[model samples]
Target chain A: MPGAETPIETIISMMVGRTLSNDALVIPDTASQPVALEVRNLNRGREIRDVSFAVRKGEILGFAGLMGAGRTEVARAIFGADRRESGDIFVHGQRVSISTPKDAVAAGIGYLSEDRKHFGLATGLDVRNNVALASLERFTSPIGVLDEAGMQREAVSYIRQLAIKTPSDTQEARLLSGGNQQKVVIAKWLLRDCDILIFDEPTRGIDVGAKSEIYKLLNALAAQGKAIIVISSELPEVLRLSHRIAVMCEGRLTGILPGGASQEEIMGLATLREPAMAVRHAS
Target chain B: MTDTTAPAPAAKTGPRISGAFHRLLAFSGLIALIVAFSLASPNFLQTQNILAILQATSVNGVLAIAATLVIITGGIDLSVGTLMTFCAVVAGVILTYWGLPLPVGILGAILAGAASGLVSGTIIAKLKVPPFIATLGMMLILKGLSLVISGTKPIYFNDTPGFNQIALGSFIGQIFPAVPLPNGVLVLFAVALIAAFVLSKTALGRYTFALGSNEEAVRLSGVNIDRWKIAVYSVTGAICGVAGLLIASRLNSAQPALGQGYELDAIAAVVIGGTSLSGGRGTVLGTLIGALIISVLANGLRILSVAQEWQTVVTGCIIILAVYADILRRRAL
Candidate 1:
């Protein structure tokens, strides 16, 4: 019982120390089983620091933080939108190197950005094209021509399944409401069969009706055994939708709280910050 | 923000309706120009003058189509004019200087142009240089290279017999004697049609629009944006090579000084054709019509004895008006 009796704080500090170097810290194989995604001491220069957490399949993990607290940066690093200085990312218990969004998508992770206008949807394209944007590889022939019929059929099915209230599949994405646009982006990643989706500010600009729809969609996705990480600045929304909550402050994970925690409890964790260890290490 | 009066389904037809409306407006503007020009000069309506206009549009039209592809990817190619000249000089070296076959010259020109575009694309995509600055550098570099290679003088293809036939000869003219449409115009038509088909039907075209619309979105979608960007520029460059072939065959020479202002003209035509300079939306047919409008205006003004300086002034004003029209349309949307 000597090794088994190591304190949790000691294990965490070991992870923090090992993260400063390039070595992947050994993860304890426990009876609980590994989650869909597990990050140990993920470091990205100054932007992200010793950030580590886990979200299992069929669970919604809410990430709550103040602006510039590195919640988005952590998500970007995990999804490979940004480069990490050191860390290990395990997707479904397999250590994976994701250096770009392309790698992340191939690894079955989808990210819905906070800024939908610029980073989430191509506003000028039709709904079908937007939905098919991530999945074009599936609809392409050997000669590099797109299979229009197949794309349309799949898009139409998603539209019906997701209840995207567009008039038809050919409707342009920009014309759709904020919620519909978000739905189209959801449909896009869903059709691509991404097992883990990171929704950053999922209902930011959506109307009340569409916000509820998105919540329902997220619930449905989770029900289907997909892992979801919702990054929301809104405490109430996060508490309502998440099964568990991870809080960050000044680029570090302060604590992971249980679901339905009071706003004050989450805020207390979110404001908890330690002195910048990255600067100390740099000097 | 809480206004729920507008249902989602009703707004669905808005894009298609507005698209058709904009195209119709541009087409009517083209028609208006034609009507105005015909009223100004009787000779403008003549078949000879119309053919001349089409011949004039051939080079610029092809170049405009090339520019359209680049612009659709939210990028630009200012080097297209000099790149076209570079292609022509490469062709001259292969055909006239080396005494090689015509096909070799054609292929050489296209390959050289594509190579130049690849370099420019790498600068833009890999180096993260903005398209305008990168293409501008490429323009100056290519222009200097063309001048240096051609010995700072025209590379004349006069010794190459039947070279002019590539542009001037017309099979359609043989079929219908009265039409007398040049092969240059036919080449422009062929290029436009193929470009249109590619833009609408192929994965490349889809990515082109995707890149222009939201490059970050496309990149995040797991597409290799850099590779597609390079491919788009290469296609644009190869098309510029075709334009080079057209101009060189027509003039029987590659004049080093003739290409500097052509980039502006091609960009102007693209903007006038309703293709947004910011990228994301365009059509080959719009570009063809835009090129025709420029040529027709130039030809008609010449027939009316209007001064060249005034003609330039009018064209500049037209470009401003076209962009203003675009702004108005987008604002309304």
Candidate 2:
């Protein structure tokens, strides 16, 4: 009957029914919806300026910038790793003040620092302790004694789920490979039930094989309905993984584009700084 | 993270072997010291001499335990000695001057120590002062305060009945006459056991290790590091209170000037126990053994009629050798 319908009727029906038939391929549903995290006018007075971006739920927001483009500064500000001069942060459309990393975590935001050895892990602690580090309160008794068995069980589960390669859950974190260490940090945040994860240089020192594994993990986390922000210097990595990419230049966010943007286009936005001649008077 | 291309299997065996070797080195060195001392002085092996050495170890052993916690957090507490004196002076004030009950005096001394430790911790954490300089300043301050509080005179606890019994009296020996161990040694064992349990089992204990291992990482994990740091110092201060109680109980008086060099002895004991002064690696059991080694060395040399001045020199050299040994062990790993 539909095939026998008139040309005008069929054209109208196709136009109206297109979304219902192929909505999954047509667009990402959350792209135009409310954002999970928003940063506005985050200025640290010296290193950062007027950085603004939004990451919707179930999306991977890639931050692509050069070495001195203030990517880390912005991330630190958002995570409250460093004090910001002025900024407004919104989590799930609700404005909140983040003065410390504790406040950030309380607001369901987690930051995995670029320097894994110094800032992302306690190298001397065992794997189970590292996984339970952030969410220790969950396994702690009322009198402050840790539930060692519960922690060990949870850690082992994460190790299995994440496929983190370690000899045993009791192995000291420092003894693990770089990729495994990164996975441990990720497991820590996940155990804390954080919905928004900011990973700074996720694969900085990881091997090629582990890099792919980490990529799979990030996608899996996004599929689990968590918003993720990935900061990377590798353009191909950013382009390949991001749903949308934001570019920064000289402490300011210059532009944002779709994931499929050309490499030349991204590089152009990444270098869009103020003219050198114009800076003479300002200095 | 430095991506070491070294094979995982090789790296694994290296640290394991070195760990066992370091423990063996420390234990054997202690045994060797005891054998050498017994050969030098026949009295060194006698039970009375052993009891005397243990009695001498009580106060210093307690202080060394306090030092162990601070050092494991990659910090030094130079104020521990003077803090002990201050606590003893407070106990004197409560028991003699205020004429309070024995329990009140004990509690008073502990509270005073905790309060002072809190001040020092706040100065270090909030003011961003380095532990060495801050505790050094605090050490001087407490030293001056102790003297001022006690009027530069020893406060005798003659009025307090059974006060000396706190350290000298042995309930264990009363029950089993053959053992004849002082109550102070029991206190040391109790403290070491409790500290070891806490360091290995509790959230507070884990934080202490984590703070030493990587403070920034802890902060990023949403932990209130400053509060935990203050707690560590406070716990140290409370332990110093117990040390104060032991020393005052032994002497039946609080001597403000007697505490000037105790911090050095305590720190030396901690180092000899193989606790890394750089932080993160230490154990209560190791600290207990270290305390014994120091006391035994001192007692043996004294029994051999070595000059006190020469004894001091030997102790200094031994401390250097112990730390050097630790460095060598770490380098081998």
**The best candidate in terms of DockQ:** 1
Tell me the deviation in Å of residue A225 in model 2.
Answer: 0.8
| Alpha-carbon runs more than 4 Å astray in model 1 | A1-34, A275-283, B1-13
Clashing pairs in 1: none
lDDT of 1 at B122: 92
DockQ, per-model, please? 0.29, 0.28
Q: Where does candidate 2 stray beyond 4 Å?
A: A1-29, A275-283, B1-11, B14-17
lDDT of 1 by residue, B1-333 (tens): 112222354563555666656667778888998899889888889888888889999999999999999998989999999999999998988888798988898899989988988898999999999999999999999899988888888888877877787789887999999888999999999999999988998899999999999999998888889999999999999999999999999989888777888999999899888898888998888888788778877887888899998888989998898888878887787
Residues forming the 10-long window of minimal summed lDDT in candidate 1 chain A: A19-28
Model 2, range B5-28, lDDT digits (tens) per residue?
222332364565665566667778
Q: For residues A1-283, could you state the per-residue lDDT of candidate 1 as single tens digits?
A: 3398886546644643321111221212222534898889999877898998988888888999899999999998888888899989999999888999999999999999999998999999999999999999888888788999999999999888887888888888888888889889999999999999999999998755566567767877877788899999988678878888899988889999887788999999887767565467567
